[model samples]
Target: MDTLTTTKPLATYVVRHADDNLVLGQRLSEYISWAPELEEDLAIANLALDHIGVAHHLYDYAAEVEDDGRDADGFAFLRDERQFTNVQLVERPNTDFAHIMARQFFVDAYQVPLWDALARSADERLAGIAAKAAKEARYHLRHSRMWVLRLGDGTEESHRRMQAAIDELWRFTGELFEADDLTDELAAAGIGVDPATLEAPWRRTVLATLAEATLDEPHETVMRTGGRRGLHTEALGHLLAEMQFLQRAYPGLEW
Candidate 1:
């Protein structure tokens, strides 16, 4: 089946995941140099690598239908913030280790379900990619869950920090479950998962994990958005400036 004529279902899923991972990966990369500890530096770098690896697989699929001849690297390093289609949460700053762990806990937990749903997509290519990414996401979730438990159940300060992080990040969590036109069309065609359907299960998983970690759920409230449509925060502009510096300065230069 020609995906282009079929509303480009699989391609949208791959590209969405890829764009989210790439943007988040770029944000995490910034911490490599600023992390308070060397172990943390390595861990952030590893996480960034994992996200970029998943992105490579996703973007490769997207490139097949891309009008331009650009490949994954080109798609990754070349795009400006306005061109990105990631969720707003990914671009949020890592305020502290506890906050970082909290955010990762939410994202990684959500990633597991997202990939698992895609693994059963009507699109075979997307299912194959999701199968591969699901394995990686599983581990990522475990790592994040462990940190959440430790921080949440640790000393008074650690517990307070973990709870505060969760409160600060809750607003962003709503966007993960928010779907758009592309998702609606794809879900109807059975080529994509409805992010809305995953909300209850996702919330259950999060609540369970947080309970195990001794974390409390804050009252649900207004959620922030805009990354899905390429509108990002001021911080994203700074991030893009750094990530796209070499690309913008020397356009068409690639090793």
Candidate 2:
């Protein structure tokens, strides 16, 4: 198996994970004042903060590995769209409450297992970050899972919306488990977990949740990909434009 046994690939791998959390966190933050209820708004804000905090640590570690003079903020706010390696799933727009819940459910299911396995990594810092992140991922999963169940089983309109969200988001999920040379090499060196290993567990949890909610499992479809390779949907570019605007407008300004 090809491996990412070099410094660059390792840094890239770490940064990709950071990018995933950062982008998704930003998306979730958009719901802070827009959530269905005041309590829900606070809940979503806290969840977004959780992801952003994890991203900060991961990006810091990646910067240290890369030794590129850039810091966590640079990686998070200054990079161009092509520089991001997060899977396309996290970058898609949150169209509605149902769409947001479905996206969170899919991502949290994958993240729970990914972080759990990474918590045992041979690299000490990576392991430490994973250990912390695994805890947050568990909470994220629980929150998202409950919302999925509520939306999927609640009212006729909610059920229809939840199913639509599931169908629309399902295609992007394949990238979560798609292994590439970077992962193969990192896994071989005990620096990273092969994402493919998390797939079975993710499916089981997602399927069980859907079943209990009375939601149908979406039929397998041709998966849209490329974010792992620095290619992404137009949506990501727009997301970045907004996210990076502050930094771009004021190159080195600080509060």
Candidate 3:
């Protein structure tokens, strides 16, 4: 039960989720000054901070599990694209406000339940991190759900755009629930939540929200994946270039 001395599997399991938050945090940060309203800009900024905060905690825990001298910053800034294990969904470009909301909604919907489940993880440290993260994810869900409803049920043009955004991102949702070997092993040990078990409730929660928003769910076809194994879209490379620039350029520079 002493996770710090655990093998790489535990560290990998924890950091994979950290990668999701770190990647999405960086994505949301890109919208910093550009959101439509002043209050909304501040909201997005706060959300970005929340995500990055969670990422740091998870990364900190992962580093401890690895029993390496590497810290959170090393995980955040030193890893190359292929080394990242975040899902592809969070890495998609924020094309527009509707797109942003759609992406946020899908991710928030998933994370709220994910954190809730993780809060009870057999790993006490991860459970503590999840307990804190669950609070932020609920707030994030409210923010995204509000915008999704407002846009999807408002003007005809807004409805079209929101629907388009939903369609564009739907394929990525499947990957969020797919359970693989790492998850299987961890779940059996009670050290992690099996995402496969989370999918049904996630569907109910998401579909209910979409119905309330008067939006049609996109039919599923292919599910985009591979981020767990370090395969990502081109966007991640560009994102890493910008996000890692300071650390990469400065090497060991301190503030």
Selected candidate, larger lDDT, 1 vs 2:
2
Off by over 4 Å in 3: 1-7
Clashing residue pairs in all predictions, respectively, total 0, 2, 0
Which prediction has more favorable TM-score, 1 or 3?
3
lDDT of each: 0.81, 0.91, 0.90
Error of 1 at 151 (Å): 0.7
Q: For each candidate, what TM-score against the reference?
A: 0.91, 0.96, 0.96
What does candidate 3's lDDT look like per residue over 1-255, in tens digits?
Answer: 221222599899999999999999999999989998999999989999999999999999899889879889999998888888899999999899999999999999999989999999999999999999999999999999999999999999999999999999999888899899999999999989999888987788789988999999898679998888888899999999999999999997779
lDDT of 3: 0.90
Per-residue lDDT tens digits of candidate 2, residues 141-247? 99999999999999999999999999999999999999988899999999899988999999999999999999999997999988887889999988889888988
Off by over 4 Å in 2: 1-7
Cα lDDT tens digits for candidate 1, 1-255: 221211355555667789888878887887787775788788889999999888898899888866457788777777766777788788878788887778777888888888899999888888898888889888888888888898889999999999999998899888899888888988898888899987887788789988997888889789988776777777777877888888789987868
